[model samples]
Target: MNRFGKGLLVAALVGVVGMAFRVSWNALRDVATATGADETAAFLYPFVVDGLMALALVATLVLTGDARRFALRVLAAYTLASLVLNYVHGLVPQLHDEVVDWGRLADWDPANWALVLLATSLPVGSIYFGSDLVAKVLHHRPIETPTTTPNQDESAETYVNRSTADLGVSAPAPITPAPAAVALPAGPGVSLVKSTDRVPVGAVAAESTRPRRATGRVPEAARSSRPVRTAEELLIEARKVTADWSDRELTAEGIRKAVHTSPAKARVLRDTLRAERAAAREASKQAARAAGPGEAAA
Candidate 1:
């Protein structure tokens, strides 16, 4: 059986058991009331039924966790035994008073009898077939052995011998490194040819030891105020580009009218412009500083 079938089986059992509880409760309550018992005794029926339900629920969780045929069988047996004992306890002449009358054939109380029958029936039925039902749902099928012909052993040995001889199971040879080459970087006004072949470590080391070109081109000064762009300038430019309209107001048409240049060019121009302004400001400040305090006061 599959999960759906097993689940349906368990659900059916629960329904039957739950109906038994309802029957037991009503029967016990009516019997207790007829006997003029106290409120406590009358309440015992629901308490006992609910207690059994809680016990069943706990057992179900524990048994389902382990999920073995033996575990389920034991659980079913436990429920069966409890149901039988509870039924017998309720039905025993000593346990309940017998209402007797002379010269009368009496019916066994319908309510009490029905409850007793239901309680016994559900658990007994469950125990007899429940384990097998659960096993079918959960157990793996058995594997079968194949019947072999007489010549099978001889054929197998012959195949193994031929396979091993063809395989040539020997150790492999060690690997060797490739030879290296020398290369140079491109120099100004000289047509440069790019090397497709990789230069080796030994050749590279020899080239590094040789005299290098001393081209007299001065590098840009790091400390020079030469207009420089900062992150702040880039963000300011982005804001200015969007300043004319709200996000919603900037339709595709409005955006097309706003800027004709590509974003890349705009970014480069914004950075260069910011740097030039900074350099000019720095030059003016330096000039003012060179003039001295007396000149500034005048």
Candidate 2:
């Protein structure tokens, strides 16, 4: 429906409900006053009765399954309660001036006692059943799970290691250098010998040949200083950091962290990498055109 149409409908609904409450309001108040309610209690009586009926009616529309059925029962009960109060109001023209005479049932007074109890107990029932209806509606409310922020250090590592693999570029894990060899003291019955040394014939006759020491040791690398890392090398490693990046934007700070380089050098490498990638993409498009339909397109 159009906005104006909805507004008109809503205004009409309000007017109708207002007029209904105005009419029922007097009858319910009379019932409350006749049932020995005080001034304040009698004034609020219509709202407690009619309000619960309206609330339950709306609850039936919102609620589902068993909850809907429960709301429907509440609506019916409150509706019946209102009907009884209005019936009592119709019978009694002078509510407080004269006591209601129940004809033959006057001695037992069960019907009058029941109507008074129902009228007075409505507020209590509204509090209980209204709260229950609200609880049922709340049960269907969608729960929002609070999200936590990622750890900064872990995020950086994730961007470097995992994001790189996603970007189709990855650097191998750093290789640990082999530990240096240690020299051991020569043991008893062990002898150091040259390849040229010969064993005597009597030595072969012994129960066991004496253990021989190493003729020579494996020589360690002469140069011990760390090798210098080139810009190209840092750019290659830094590819892992920027490759999986959605924006595909390279930053000097990110490059510096990835390859552990100076900020100035990182900036230089960043520009070089961007240019290289751009050129590579251009080459691919050109190659795709050249390849035509004969071979797999670039």
Candidate 3:
């Protein structure tokens, strides 16, 4: 509802509740007095009733989801209700036997004025309860921050060492360089052997010196295989070969050769080129019409 509508509703509720509390308080006080209750109990009866009303208001504020708005409404309603009840209590001769004229409030005893102040202050003091209720209603659970464990803080080397110890495995020894080889006396037709491999050095040297030849023919497997070409690459190559040729002179075979694509792709490229040319011609005609007769003639 709009703000005005909500305000009207709250005002109506406050009127109804205030009237109900007034009636109930009078009835309870009468019953307590008639039942031979002590003077102290009868005297404190109205305060008890007001306290219960305040408690109910606090509970309503606490339970509602929109506690903030409800708390404000409750405060306004309680203030209005308190003022109305206080005025009624002051005016009614049966309720307040002491006759203090409205214009003579300044002349009234300090104790009587103090009592009036306390009664009005009761509802205002409940403002704190409303605030507490709102806080409780709208409170949210705190988010937990992420924390690192001891293991996560350890270095890679430390982790590896710990793991090896747990598994009862020893780490491998560090690698050491071998001693330099001593030269032996050269014998006829003897070849030097390297420590890295068993293969003769002469064979590797011979392979490196051999000449390489280029073959124009593709391998049987490669010739049968079809390579993937993007639509952009095919269109680019098709445009290049067909740039100097008219739409009628362009052929699927020429496009396939220019882009090295399959027959099906070549046919698609041919159709695309025809569509593009048709579109261009249509655009030129539209531009000429828009330019008018004088511009066309020029």
TM-score of every model versus the real structure = 0.24, 0.45, 0.27
Clashing residue pairs in all predictions, respectively, total 3, 0, 0
Which of 1 and 2 is the better model by lDDT?
2
Clashing pairs in 1: 227-275, 227-276, 228-275
Per-residue accuracy of model 1 over 1-298 as CA lDDT, tens digit each: 9999999999999899789777666555544434444567666744443444454444444443334445455556545644554555455544344352321112457754564455434434544544454554455344467677658977788678755654544433433444453465757875444353434434321123223455586566734664555656644654577655454554444433454445665655455445655697899999888888879689
Ranking by TM-score: 2, 3, 1
Give per-residue CA lDDT, model 2, range 28-110, as digits (tens).
87677666677798788899999998899989888878889999999999999898778767766666454544222123479
Assess candidate 3 and give its lDDT.
0.61
Q: What is the C-alpha lDDT of each candidate?
A: 0.52, 0.75, 0.61
After superposition, which runs of candidate 2 have C-alpha atoms over 4 Å from their true positions?
A: 96-108, 142-298
lDDT of 3 by residue, 1-298 (tens): 9999999999999899788767656643433343344567656655554654565466564564555456556556555645554454545444443333432223346844654454444434555654565465567334466586666767666668655555563434444545555688879987655566344344321122223355588777777566566998789878877888877677888778877788999999999998888999999999888889877689
